[model samples]
Target: MIKLQVIGNLGKDCVVNNVNGKSVINFSVAHTEKFRDAQGNQKDKTIWVECAYWTDRTAIAPYLKKGTQVYVEGAPDIRTYSTQDGRQGASLSLRISNVQLLGTRSSDGEGGSSYNSGPSYSAAPQHVSAPPSSSQLNEPADDLPF
Candidate 1:
């Protein structure tokens, strides 16, 4: 069995469909790779992956909106077909076994999510009491024959 994992922003809102009485959520994830060419020119290449998550837990569909970052893991499949012009086209798709929302893009197109607008951390850690010293070790080891 082959497994694939992808972390990227959603291309569009997820859609839930019922086929043969089974619910499936469909969405797309786009991953962009950045690199420099031989001439030191920066370039980016984006790969789009279609996902189909079959589950009864469709509650998560609402959160799978456009620009929402997510992590998905599943079985990968490549589909190839012929276009009307006799050209071959291929797409990478996944049958999602698990999906999780990572964050969301701010409305102002900022780099962070509004979900994290509040305090970035919790209260400071409390100091813990020190352990017992050697002198405090169990009545100085009572002598006993094993």
Candidate 2:
């Protein structure tokens, strides 16, 4: 089995469609890469990935708008086709299995908050919930489970 995961900002708003009684939400994520070229020129390459999330609940469609950052994991599908000009082109798409609402505007917060939860990816990743301090993560040699 092959799995792919991508974390990036949404390129455009999502579309919810009802196909054969199943709800499907379609969106796209833009993953970018920055590197130096052979001539020592910095180049930025962005790849767009179309994602389809199939679920019974269409409740989250409203929040899955443009610029909303998302983390998606699923199977990668590379589709090839000929362009109108007879040129060849390919697109990247994903069949999503999991979708999580990281954050949303104050009114759209998944969990009620004093104020709407802001952006989810603006900050670096870390353990935010109340938990034992780092000491627990760096415990001395112990005998529990290897």
Question: Which 10 residues in a row give candidate 2 its minimum summed lDDT?
Answer: 114-123
Cα error, residue 22 of model 1, in Å, equals 0.5
| lDDT score for candidate 2 against the true structure | 0.78
What C-alpha lDDT values do all the predictions have? 0.86, 0.78
Q: Give the poorly placed runs of model 2, Cα more than 4 Å off.
A: 102-146
List of clashing residue pairs for candidate 1:
none
lDDT of 1 at 33: 96
Candidate 1, residues 1-146, lDDT tens digits: the string is 99999988899999999999999999999999999999999999999999999999887888888888888999999999999999999999999998877777777756544543211112366678999997887664676556
Best by TM-score: 1
Q: Which run of 10 residues does model 1 get worst, by summed lDDT?
A: 114-123
TM-score of each: 0.76, 0.69
lDDT of 2 at 40: 100
